[model samples]
Structures are given as C-alpha cells and as structure tokens.
Target: MASPVSSPKKNTRNRKLCTPPNHSLFFLSLLVSMITFFGISVLSFMPISLQDSYLLPLLSPSSEPFSSPSFSSAENRSQVTLASLALTFLDSEENEPILSNSVMVPLPAHGIVGSNVSEEEREFWRQPDGEGYRPCLDFSIGYRKASVRITEEKRRFLTVAVSGGLNQQRNGIVDAVVIARILEAALVVPVLVVNQIWRDKGEFSEIFDVKHFKRTLQADVRVVSSLPSTHLRSRQTIETMQMPSDVSPLWIRSRFLRKLNGDGVSILKLQGLYSRLSKNLPSDLQKLRCKVAFHALRYAAPIRELGNRLARRMRIEGPYIALHLRLEKDVWVRTACRTGLGAEYDDIISKIRGSQPEYLRASQNMSYLQRRLAGQCPLNSLEMARLLKALGAPRSARVYRAGGEPFGGKQALQPLVAEFPNLVTKDNLARDGELSQYSNRSSALAAIDYIVSLSSTVFVPSHGGNMGIAMQGHRAYVGHRKYIKPNKRSMLPLLEDTTISNAEFSRAMRKLHAKSQGQPEMRTNKRDRDVLAYPVPECMCKHSVNNDVSHH
Candidate 1:
C-alpha cells in the first residue's frame, strides 16, 4: 500500500509546497527593498562631509560592509535623534521615520534640522549613554590609574617658570607636567612670573592648590614643591634649559634626556613655557594636559572659598552669564583694533600702539576696520552689548564680567551695562575687602574669575584670548554650557549692517552661533592650535549613543 502511494512519484514539487513556508528570506528581501526606497530619502539629508567617508559604500552593491568611521558627522547635518534614525530602518509596524513623501512634503518629523532651531530645543530629552554623560564634567580618563616611573637614586627635577596671566600660567603649568613626563623627570611646582600689568605676585601655591597638583599628577608625573634639598647646593638657583617653541615629543626626549641624566640629581628650569610643547602630542600627553588644566590646577583653598562665595552670590539671583570682556589697554594696544566707543577711544588705542613697539598688531596688512570686521580684534563694548542682547540674554540675567579692567574704565562697559544693567565684576559681587586681600594678585583674581566663569550657566568670550580659549575648553570639559564664541568675521558684518532690524540681527546671530555653542571638539594638528582649547575625542570620551556631540 505504501508503494502504491509512492507511485504518485512523491509529487516532489507538491511535497515542497506541503512544507512550512520559509518567509524569512522573503521578509529580508522586502526589508532590503524598503530600506533602499527610504534610504534614498535618508541619504538626501546625509551631511556632505560624511558623504565621502561612508554611506557610498553602503549604497553600493558591495559584498563587504562599510567599516565604521571613528567619528560620525551626522549631528552637523541634523540634530535628529538616534531613535528617529532607528525608526527609519524599522519595519512598518513600529513608529515610522518621516516617510519618503514627507521629505518632499516637509512635515515636522521631530524638530526641523536648521539654524532656526534653538540649541536648547535640540537637546535630546532622553538620558545619554553614560548616565547622560553629564554631570558632563568627567575629563579624567583613567589618568589617576596610569603609573609614573619613579627613579630613586638619580632623581631629576624639571623646574619651569609658568609666565603670563592666570590662564597663560595655567597653560604653562600644564606644559611643564607634559615636558617633565617626556623627559621622564619629576616636575617642581611651577614658578609664577609676576605679570607686569596686573603686578600679580601670586605664586603657584597661592594660585593653584599645590597638594592637589602633586597628588593628581602623582601617577602621571612626580610634582614636587621645589627641587630636592640636595639640588639646592648648586651655584645656579635653577639650571636653565632653552626649549624650542611648539616642541615635539621626540625633540623633548632627545634634547632633555641627557640633561636629566647628566647630574645624579638635576633641576632643569625653563621660563615662558607657554606654547613650548606641541599641541598634537600622543593622545596620552594631550590627556595629561587636560588632567592638569581641568583637575590638578585647582584654586588654593582660600581662593576656592572666596570664589565659591562670590559665585554663590553672583548666581543667587539667577543663572548668570560669565562674559570675558577683553577690553584692557594691552588688548586694545596689541590688537590695534577700534573700540566702536567712537573715534576718540580708537585714537587713544592708536596713540598707545604707535608709541609702543612692544604692543602687537595682529597683522601688518589688516587695518582697524578690516581687523574688526575680520574678527581679528576683540568685540568692543557696544558689539558685546548688541551680541548679548541679540542672543536673548534675559533682561534681568546678571552678567559676571571676567577679565582685567576695561580699557575705557567704567565707560567701556556702559553699552553692556545699559543693555543688561546687572553686569557685575568680582569687585561688584565681592564683599568689601574680600577681594582687597588679593588686590594686587591678578593671577588670584583671574583664578577667581576662572572659577566663576567655569561655573556659570553661560560663558561668553568677547575675544579669543588665552582666557577665552581656556574657558571655552573648560566649559566644554564640564557640561557644554552655552559658550557663544562671537563668529567675529561673519558676525561683525551682520552687526555693523544698520539696515537689518533687531529681530533679523538676532536671527542671524542665532544662526551664526548655532554650532559654536561650546560643543566638544577634538583639537586639530594645525600649527599652534592649542590642545587645551579643543579637548574632545582626546581628553574626553563618549558613548556611541552620544554621537550627536562627536564634533571630531
């Protein structure tokens, strides 16, 4: 009977039909089609910068998959959430991405990706991967764990005179640690050369917490208060070493290695150590710099207490704006730029600049108006006022002005004060005699400024000085609080145009600064581009989920 049944030739094709339908392959094919259809629409929004790096391979019929790039520039093109992107790939049942037709129809998917979108509005409402990557203040990337090689008998010390004002000295101190590491020598607490302008006698210990500096860098470099007692017998106070500017890691090791080993216990001192070390060092060195600047260089306990107190007072009313108003005599003289306080102020700056060859002119070719428009000069008080107002500075928001005394004195800040009357400096906010204690100590005062600026809800720098650069980097190192770096070149043109209404100017300002909002960015190897300024993808790490901020 079975043979009889078999005689039907088993209906080979029918037997195949009888089996359960294997729809997996069919579904996969359908998915691929759906993706291809919508991918065209998604590809439309693909940022031009990323088009060359990836996506092309993905679009092509290739056997091999696209190798993931180290960074994603998708955030530059669109602040679209990763979830929306996921939904775009998802099956029909799930929440759908803006359909292929929606791209043409221009329906709101989440928020439209463009300059009109406010920075705060673009914030992803959900928590980021690393506990929202916030208290975004984690610049310490296992630096505490990395061990420093200790040389017992032939201990060597690198003494560096960290010159310039507070931020400049801060950078120099950072360089000293890195150079010490490169030379494999212990670092002495940096010597703070009193700045001539501020007449600041603030020592390293008076400015930065020495114990914290030493302990924080114990694993990275041995930081000592001074050379060992044995080295004090030397005829020279500190053996001087001439280091090149923007020195490479190899150059440092090669040049200083012999010097360190020359004597049993040596102390090599170098002054004006700013920009001496290369910016694009090995990632470890860059990170070490970040560790020093962000963590190790804490203000002295007293300074911290005063700074905290002042900061508390400043913010007590409401979240304040830390404006780094660079309107000092030196700034005007050096930049050789106009103040927009009228020809009188400009004439004064010109007279001072012409009188002193010591003062720098950014470029011989760039003239005053040219420099101002080019953003080569610092934003004048009037410009700062317009910018702050255009950026929607709350009429009542207190602005904590950080930097030296304005060039025009109280008159220099009249425009800003008039627009936002709550503009207060450390002196204004300080309890009587509180700042008097550190009166002559500019570094200490700037350190106080630094602390307040770092802790502010919004930090705006009028010019790109050492302090501004450092503050921007520090602000980013912490949570990326609003840092509106005036797009000097583009912005000045907009600001000077008398025809545009306030609303239009505000729109333009928002558009110009949309991407300049203190986003974390890795430092480029461009010659003299400071690493401390751009401390991202090197000093900072982020979860893949936070690719929106990967401004690498």
Candidate 2:
C-alpha cells in the first residue's frame, strides 16, 4: 500500500534530469560541449582545403569542415633551416657545350706566328711533312674536355690553382695543397708557381709528399690569374691573348686574366697541367656545369661526410652549425679599415645572434680572458693601454667593450671561447696537417656552412681584399642578401641606389609594427607610396668606424 501511494505522485509531470548535488559529471559534460561547439565554429570559418588537409582528417577522418580560404602560405612565414634548404647548388648549364654543333672555331696557332720561329722553337714542333698544322684546335678541345672531366669529378673538390700569387713565406701553397688532399680528388695538379713550390724538395716537401705526383703526367699548366705582374714582359704576354669565358682554357683565359698572350711556358705549362689532370680525370668531371655545381657533387659530400663523422664522434646530430673562425690573418688589413680582427669576430657573433631564435643564443664571447691567461709576461698596464689604444678603444671603457680590437692572432680565440660557452673552434679537417687561415678556401667554406647551420644571419665584411669569388658565390647560393660597403669614391651612388618602393616599404612597416609594441617613427623623408630605402651600416660607411654611429 505504501509503494502504491509513492508511485501515484511519480506520474503527473515530466521532470527533466537535474544533476546530482556534486554535479561533477554535469560540469565536465558542459565544458566538453562548449569546447566542441567553439571548435566546430572555428573550423567552419577556416579554409576548406586546410581543414580537409589537416583538422577534419585528424578528427573525424572523413568530415569536410572549413569551406573557405582567406590566408596564404607565403604570409605564414617561418624560419628556413639548413635541412630544409639542403644546400642548393645552381648550375651554369649555359656554360656546357652543346655537342649539337660540331662547327667549332679554329684555335689560333701560337708557336710559329709571323714566321719568326727560332731554330729552337722550330725544332720544338719539327714535323716530317714540314710541320703540318699541329691540330691545335683539336688538341685544345681535347685538353679542355679532359680538364672538364677533372673539374666535373672534383666539382666535389676545390680546383685550387696554387699560383705564386696565393703563396707566401709562412702560409705556403701547403694550405691549398692540403685542401686538395683532403677533398680526395681524382687529381690534384698545382697551377704555375704553386706547383713549383709543391714540387720543391725543401722544408715544405719534408712536410708534404712529392711522390704523390709520380702517379702524375707532366704537371705543367699556366693559369692566368687575377694578379699584377713583376715584369713588363709578363704583362705584355698577358695583354696579347683573347679572353674566353667557359671553365675551359678559353673560359679560364677569358675570366681569370684581363687579357691573354702571357709567357709561352706559363701557357704551355697550364696546358700541360690540364693534360696531366685530364689523363687522371674521371667521368664525373663532365657532369660539373658550374663552380657551384662542383660544390654540390664534390665539396659538400666531403664536408658533409666530415661533418657527420665529427657529429658522431662528438655525440651530436643533424642540427649542428659550422663556424669558421679565421684567426690566422687580418682579412681586411690593407683595404678599408685597418681595424683589428677582434671586431670581425664581434661582427660574426652579432650577426649570428641576431638571426638565431632566442633559444640558440645560449652561447657566450670570451676573447678577453684567453688573452689575459696566455702565458706571456702580463703586459704592463701601459702596454695594455697602447695596445687597446692602437685597437681604437677608448681607454675609459672596459676591455671587453673596447670595440674594434684586432685579434692578436689566434691568441684572441682563447678569450672568444671563454665568452661563448657552446662555441666550437675545432679545425681538425686536414688529412695533411695544415692550419686554416682567413685566406684558406676550404677552411672558409667549412666555416661558412657551419655558421649558416647555427644561425640564419651571416655577416661578410666586404667583397674587397682576399675574399675569393668562390666564397662570394657560396654565400649568394645560400640566400645571403649582399650589402656592399660605401667608400670615399662613392657617396651619391650609394644614396641614389638605396631606394625602395612603397609597397615593400609599407609591408616592412606593418611587419615591424606587428612584432613591436612601441616603435619609433621612421626618419625617412620620402613619402611616395612607391618609393622606399634602407641605409648601409656604419661598418660599411666611409666616414671612419663609429664616426657617425648614430646613423646606423
């Protein structure tokens, strides 16, 4: 009877399910529902392609969500990494000879020109049929093809011509020779003087092996280089020949020397060298189309292999950055500013730090302590003052803040490492125990790749002086936006050329605003929507370093 009475009240009205007193389930369900609703709404507004490509496929596997696109991939900018770039090497496909045309131009006769052939010279090419045309064209082409083969194979290698031009008392052709050795080329023939030096049985020979050349053909090749001559006769020889532009002999003559007609021995030596190289050259040389093309096929493989080996030994991996610190010589010594090398280090660090994400700048600068701790008698305070003063530092400022101090050689590096914790200064790349200096190509390139890997920004001081074309070409390949220095010879040109357009200017302004909360006003005078500009840095200005630092 009591059960019947309770059941009677349960019938009349339908009551909704009210949650229990705790209501934990109710709150959780409500939270889930709200999240779902918002997510669905957001998805609806997103691009249909994006939703189909990512979200919907991730969530429901089949549902089409976003139906429109108002965003672009380009606008969604992100930092480019070394892995992503993969070190692209553009080829000079145009330079490649199209075997399509067999109508080749005849090469000029060199030996018996003007019927002034001396008895010795005439005897050199004395032939049975009264010196029948020596097939100079065919010989030249064949030699070129052989050199091409060598270039192609070594495209993975550096074609370093060790002319007397690149050699010195302390830094011999050994640096370039060692680089060639490290690359493991199919052949390594020195150009002109460098070859002579390499072949010498002196102290350098004690350190290097002339026997390596025994597997060689007559290692003679005259390479026209971009250097001034000591003798008027040499200069006249240089002035007489027509310049050709392919990486072939003609190309070398055309591109490297301003004019041709140099010494016969030099030219013959060069041809001989090429012939020797050709004899030993592999088929891979034919594949090389550009200077950069060789880098991809040849140099990078060795560098990458070396880098990977280094990483494995050091317990690191793919994400490492290369740093080439040229502590040996002043790269900018005779040119623009006679500043110390320390400033270059500072410049390198600043550039590296700026482009790197906040997380990567974890390293520090330590040149100071290294200099202090090096075991020489501590410089008297006066000696220190003079050194600092010579380095263009204000005596009142701290030694660390003293800007533009030359690295007193590699001694400066000790302090640099202390300052930067994760800084790697390993230079053990040579199979041939040669130290890398600023002028060393292999070292420079290795350092380039390292720095590029570590940081997005790279700072190359200037193109003048010893900065080689190979290095410049490398930087350009890696997306380096170049900034040339403005010297005393050109101000109006600098100002005239610095202009930018309005659309670009506007976008830059907007980007700056989006990234910064309170930026100062632009100091530019041009208000035209289509015109804009940027200034060269103080370092590049002709008014002496820091003279008008405020402009920077």
User: What local distance difference test score does each model get?
Assistant: 0.65, 0.26
lDDT of 2 by residue, 145-252 (tens): 444433333112223333322212112232222222223222333333333312332222222222322111111121122222432234232212222221233333
What is the lDDT for 431 in model 2? Answer: 37
Candidate 1 least-lDDT 10 residues: 100-109
Question: Any runs in candidate 2 off by more than 4 Å, and if so which?
Answer: 1-267, 270-297, 300-304, 311-327, 330-333, 336-411, 414-419, 428-472, 475-552
Q: At residue 464, what lDDT does model 1 achieve? A: 89
TM-score per candidate: 0.72, 0.27
Shift of residue 114 alpha carbon in model 2, Å: 76
Model 1, 13: alpha-carbon shift in Å? 75
Say which candidate scores most in lDDT: 1
For candidate 2, the lDDT comes to 0.26
Output the TM-score of candidate 2. Answer: 0.27
**CA error at residue 57 for candidate 1, angstroms:** 42
